[model samples]
Target: MSDKKTLQEIEKEHRDSHFAEKSMQYWRSWGSWFSWGSPVGLGLFFIETAVAAWIVAQIVK
Candidate 1:
């Protein structure tokens, strides 16, 4: 018998790996902000949100 992954299996594995990487990145960023305390975390949160909103607005225009 030969060992081979089907196309669907390969796609699923790639998606799962991508999601895991994104999740790790999110948590690492969150932890970095959390370590800085509430004020700094809140500041960073607002800055990120504003940037996201601006991007969305630009896209909508």
Candidate 2:
């Protein structure tokens, strides 16, 4: 057998590397904005939920 990667294998590797890079970029740029662990993100989420609940309560009354 020859020591060579098939075309599909090469393409898969390239695609996987691209995906990993993009994922890292996303995490660095905007992931914290939506992450529950971040204080700002968590605060925003709680505020939104509270507003929604209040609206529902008003509608149900």
Candidate 3:
């Protein structure tokens, strides 16, 4: 029998050959910053609020 690749197999081989994978996709690195930024910003806001309250209390004492 003659050896031959099917259309699907040939297409798969072509697709695999042209595969492009970026170690860092567009804005992928900034993804972590976005994910972590909300929590960090919230934490800072709470800290600032607490400090402001404490300062006001101390001043009123």
Candidate 4:
């Protein structure tokens, strides 16, 4: 319940914290997923779809 914290004090505390570094690290980790993971996931999805379509075609023939 310490409501006496000044804005400058809060800003100083934030500067001393590792919040920015940790947040950047989090986004860097997800950056790989965006760069490489999405294409791999899409490739798998297309493969599965092709397999399913082929099976359906075989059954219908």
Task: Using TM-score, give the best candidate's number.
Answer: 2
> How does residue 58 of candidate 4 score in lDDT?
100
RMSD of 2: 3.3
Q: Runs in model 4 with CA error above 4 Å?
A: 1-37
Instruction: Go through the candidates in order and give each one's C-alpha lDDT.
Output: 0.90, 0.93, 0.73, 0.82
Question: Which window of ten consecutive residues has the lowest lDDT sum in model 4?
Answer: 32-41
* Per-residue C-alpha lDDT of model 2 across residues 1-61, encoded as one tens digit per residue: 9889999999999999999999999888787777889888899899999999999999999
Q: Give the TM-score of candidate 4.
A: 0.41
lDDT of 1 by residue, 1-61 (tens): 7599999999999999999999999999878776647788778788999999999999999
Local accuracy of candidate 4 as per-residue lDDT tens digits, 1-61: 8879999998988886778888899998777665535886567678889999999999999
Where model 2 places Cα greater than 4 Å from the true spot, the runs are 6-16
Best by lDDT: 2
RMSD of candidate 3 to true structure, Å: 9.2
lDDT of 3 by residue, 1-61 (tens): 8599899999998776665334355457656555536776567678889999999999999
Count of clashing residue pairs in every prediction: 0, 0, 0, 0
Worst 10 residues of 3 by lDDT: 18-27
RMSD of 1: 10.6
- Give all candidate RMSDs, comma-separated: 10.6, 3.3, 9.2, 6.1
- Choose 3 or 4, whichever is better by lDDT: 4
